[model samples]
Target: MQALYDVPAPAKLNLFLHVVGKRPDGYHLLQSIFTLIDWADTLHFERRGDGRLARHDGADAMAELPEDDLCLRAARLLRTESGDAALGANIHLEKRLPAGAGMGGGSSDAASTLLALNRLWGLNWPLARLLPLGLKLGADVPFFLGGRNAFVEGIGEILHPVDLPAQTYFVLKPPTSIATQEIFSSPLLARSKSVAIVAGFPAHNSSDDKNESLQSTGAEVVKLDAQGVAKLCGGFGSNDLQKPAEAICPEVRQALQLLEARYGNSRMTGSGSAVFARVSSEEKDGMSNQSMATMLQDLPGAWTGKICRGLDRHPLSGWA
Candidate 1:
């Protein structure tokens, strides 16, 4: 195929994040469940025979992006790593997910770029082969490359696949963006000493038998089925970064308050500036899209909000 059109780069939510420990290298050790969502960025690719890589803003959403955007960087990295200088592509990104919202947008786009180019360039590299290159781009890149809901650890290089139930969420993004580096470096940021056990979380202990197993194993078991997973997530865990994010940006707190007022429970996803609340099945079943929109009619015009459904796997999960 000479082109790949309407390729999806899905976003992710850290259902729960914990700063279990800090590495000697200054990287923080974490435990989080990374779940894919319906919200995504669209990408289109056309093969170039001249081996010249180029990028364009398909939707004008990426007009300000630099030449070193993750998508382009991924392309260059793959080309160099594969030693295929003759392979080239014209990439157009339809940016949808907001940048710096801790939604894993850039990382997802980079992962999708790698996956698409793997096909368009005829390299056919497996996910395993591309993983190290992806890690070089960002910590979240490897999770997106994995294409499944995962229990992530060790500065995000380690991943253990976990099945999650299909569910809906209301994700709200405020006008302001929080710099991840700023949040990480903040003196006010909480360095949580309490390590989280997978079984101690709601989604991880959905069944009595599973709870029994966890108790017997001292919460060492780490895998769960889809139903159990669905029961486990959806505003289930805390984000250790939320306090610092709010301290840096009041908009983050505003978004959380708004979502919490409606949904009763809300938490910041990833780092900051974006907050989400789980829409219970009973509520989702009773409300239509129009009704849902009406409920959120009072949201600030400057803010962006969407009702998103969680995905079991990445759209391009099998592509690699």
Candidate 2:
């Protein structure tokens, strides 16, 4: 029996997202650096002769996503594109990350499926071919396929490889999930800032190169060495959707405030209800097992949390 087991679909955080403008199609123009994290959902696939796609875990039994799952769709798309009928696999997802926390769980899952099936089916589709299909899955899906750190832009499809500092983070998800589209459409959303682009990474938060309208009022400069980068992920980086998300979900606001109080540099990831803090690498060694336990114990009765390390690369490509 040809089988592949324990493939990783890693989560990601947008270190910072700047909305340059909106396109004619109503998609927002964005510029951000995305880094993969070690926190992941695992998939196990066993080739089946019967050609049926099955998911044994991860998704809720009543969650209604199995029928519309990107994982299954990815497999189907690959099969159709390659014109192969003898390929099939039984997928078992070991879901660890929370859904809709803006952690890219589903997109990661879909990308992993595309990769695993490409190998298992022996079709040998190049990453470029797999990418357009993955875009059909999610904007974030293609980044995982790129398999390296990137400066992403243009509704999250265009990608440019970047050399990003490696780091670890403590990501905390509140009890609620914020819908991505709703956050984008909020009337309270700040969208009038002049679209500005910096030539290179600024010194964590000097904002000297940023336009006045695009600068955060509370921004602070931070120094991140390799070790410091591994621990505390630079300074208090900002996300465009955070304010709107917080305005709609008080739980998200509370999560950010609490993490900031303890960790100093805290912010929400993606279109979040999840907030994270930059812990110094030295501090990370001290907490390895104890910090998560301590933080969870202290968390409000209504939240879910985890300690996620920043990755200089996506997890799946380590397989390639």
Candidate 3:
């Protein structure tokens, strides 16, 4: 049987997330910048002739996942869409990242599965061909598959690649898992009525780099104006869902405070629970794991924290 081993599913930090509007289908239209981080989960796949999809969980992943988790859904979706009935695999997941932290862990796993299995099964599908299947799994999945730090829009399907500087981050996952639906359903979500983008969003495609608006601060991130629109200068936009998430989960607030107290600034990544603070860039030699450990020593045993550097692209970016 052909197999793929030790495949990585890297996590993502949404530099900022903005809800621009609500679609007629009740889906919230969103704009965000997604950057990959070093922290990740691992997946392994073994090809099987028996046309049966199975999952074997490795230790350390949080609570029992649903029967139809995103991994299986991605596989099943790919198989069903491929017009091939006999393709199947036994998937092994060594999940280290915390779920429901809005870190895009599971979606990354699913995207990696599609990329790895496409190779293991010799389907040789391109990134474009696999992206639609990915979007069926989740909005975040396509960003991982796109394989770059991007300014994302259109309910998360439209991706505009951006040039981002390298930086270090300390991500904290408080002992709480937030329900994404709950946060989105909250009446307090800060969906902006009008959205203004930076100079170059997409005149046509990612290749149009003539007038891209990117301003830099010290180890800076992309920021937006108070009206919920991206600005041409420094600072990133807000994770609009953070307010609702904090209201629902007090741990979100606690985690934000802890990181802010130490790093001088902290913001919830995607939705809730996991908040991150910019550490130092590699030019500064980066933050040491030992120092991170020392700072986290007094925190509750249930909480999980990590010192991660940003990745230029997905590990399997070249696979498809």
Candidate 4:
């Protein structure tokens, strides 16, 4: 193999996702602040001189079932654009992020594939040129190319960069899977939302504000060692589908209740099932990580939960 590609595809959280309306094409228009998280899946690619694409061992087993799998689809799309009929490669995907948790794992995987193959197949296109191709794969794919904290609007293709204070978060998920399309298509889905096309970015508390005002509002909130950063549960934000999701999936509700009761601030991440809470970094000074783990262990139920910190930014780059 003459060319090699390795990429990290990261997960995302909709800090505050709102449903403004629905498009005539059945796509829901949304406004959200998308923060990239550290959790991710990684994929590696290698080019074969012959015009034959193969998947390695277990990777082929996963790909054999779907011609339209995001990774394969991205490869084909990149090839079509480059007109490289003889271009072929082997892709190895290391799946880590949980699928259908509204974390954009598959979309990130697709974005990585498109970017990696553009180089491995010898297509020298800039990230901007590849974005539209990524959009064809999924709306969230383009955001991965932007690779920063973004204020996303439109059908989620529009992007504006924003600066958000980072903190540690405890992410929790119940044993339930949600179909994004199903949630978007239900009659119960809310569509009558006012458009939020502000001229400038939303304001966040700066360091001075964090010390004086942000910490005064709640007891559970804690300021980080850095200036103007608060680590707490509960946010000044919400997700659009949370109510509808709770109605359809009870496990999601149970997970939220459990998280909120222990930590006092918990909300769903993307669509459903996966919910998270803000944990004070300073809380460790008073208690240990093992104590927190024991807190969740004592909870009555069967669900998957983890204590992970929020990301200062997305984990990968197209050029990296």
lDDT of each: 0.80, 0.74, 0.78, 0.70
TM-score of each: 0.88, 0.84, 0.86, 0.82
What 10-residue stretch in candidate 3 is worst by lDDT? 225-234
- Against the true structure, candidate 1 has what lDDT? 0.80
**Model 2 lDDT tens row, 1-320:** 37889899988887777676776888887766677889999998888776677777655541223557888888888888887676778888889889888888999999999998888877677887888988887788888888976667767787766654556678898889988989999986766444444344333222333553222212122223464233324342357788899889999888887877877777778898777887766777777477679878888886787777677677667443
Residues 1-320, candidate 3: write the lDDT tens digits: 39999999999988777787887888888877788999999998989887878888755432334656988888888888887889989889988999888999888999998998889888898889999999989999999999888878888898877556566778999988989999988998876534534554543223233423444322123332322212211155577899999899998999988877876678898876899877644423654657656777878788988878878778998899
Model 4 residue 224 CA deviation (Å) reads 15
The Cα error of candidate 1 at residue 72, in Å, is: 0.4
- Please estimate how well model 4 matches the true structure, expressed as its whole-model Cα lDDT: 0.70
Give the number of the best model, judged by TM-score. 1
Q: Per-residue lDDT for 280 in model 1?
A: 77
Which digits, one per residue and each the tens of the lDDT, describe model 4 over residues 1-320? Answer: 36554578888777667787777987877777677777778888888666656555363252342676888888878887887689878888888777768888888988888777777776768988988998899988888877776768777788777555656666777778888877776677777654443335433212232221222221222113333223212443357788788888888898888878866767887786688776665664566778877877865575666666556556555363
Query: How many pairs of residues in model 1 come into backbone collision?
Result: 1
Ranking by TM-score: 1, 3, 2, 4
lDDT of 1 by residue, 1-320 (tens): 89999999999988778776777888887777788999999999999887678788766432334657899899989999888788888899888999778999999999999999999888998889999999999999999999888878778988877766677889999989998889889998776535555543334212233221211111323455444444444334478899899999998998888877877768788996888887778888999878977866767877888899999888898888
Model 3 residue 100 CA deviation (Å) reads 1.1
Clashing pairs in 1: 203-232
State the TM-score for model 3: 0.86
Q: What TM-score quantifies how close candidate 1 is to the native fold?
A: 0.88
